[model samples]
Target: MTLPRLFAIAILSLTPGLTAHAGGKKGENSGISFHLQGDPSDNPKMIFEQNTAGKQVVYRRNPDFMTKDVAAFNSFPSQDGQGFGVVLQLKPSAKNRLAALTSANIDRWMLAMVNGRKVDAVIIDKQVEDGYLVIWKGIGQAEIDAFDTQVPRIGEKKPRR
Candidate 1:
């Protein structure tokens, strides 16, 4: 009946092998939001509006540059070879868009979401060369794994409940 409910239903209808998980405390909203950036009605760019714990969060993706699709995900050591980070391998088409992003867009914020939750608001510092979108700061293995698992789950076909 609410936007969140409608969103959950819509997601359920679209995804395959989706199941309603119970066992949590009753009346608690345990639904997770998983969506890409950008509004399909207005812009094809990466931007998404998500609801988390009854709060509305808007994720604004770069207008000039957006990932076409995630090709793969990998965990690697940081660029300085210290600590660790996640690398998002984007589709080939994303390479063209990445070319438009230069050092000027550095420090600009971009959203990296997982299951409809705002996981990381990454700020770019160097050029997003090639199709590898490296996220080192303000990210952990959990968020990376979520994105890795959930992105491919969009637009799937599940049996009617």
Candidate 2:
């Protein structure tokens, strides 16, 4: 392979890894990429907007666990003040912090059921809170069900004192 071609391939491959760390000020989780927007100041904002035309699943850090999961994720604003959000906890939080970036849209934030049960996919609607909202989909029904139940729970670390 030519030197120039080899160099090009190397850069292209590393591109994903580099972008993965982009704006990682919040956390580093695997199988997750988010398209965020809107300020949390508002009650309900377009937190996670989906780009794909197909259905999507979205997850946000549970508001109740904001201060709890300080290192896991951070809170922003809803920008609208009338939206709700769901938290998503990656099994291996240290696997792939950044996979691929997606486009966010209004009214794409939702945690609904696909096969008669609540799923983790947020759908990237405009009813979610701001901060770092990830839009994921094509997940199994079982996994989605789990996320719907308590994936957002940022367990309280025992008192350090």
Please name the candidate that would achieve the greatest lDDT relative to the true structure. Answer: 1
Candidate number of the best TM-score: 1
* Per-residue lDDT of candidate 2, residues 14-35 (tens digit): 7876656668733433222333
For candidate 1, the lDDT comes to: 0.50
CA lDDT of each prediction against the hidden true structure: 0.50, 0.36
Candidate 1 Cα deviation (angstroms), residue 111: 1.7
TM-scores, all models, native as reference = 0.40, 0.22
Candidate 1 TM-score versus the reference: 0.40
**Native-to-model Cα distance after best TM-score fit, residue 99 in candidate 1, in Å:** 2.5
lDDT of 1 by residue, 98-145 (tens): 645545556555555433334445546678667766556444556545
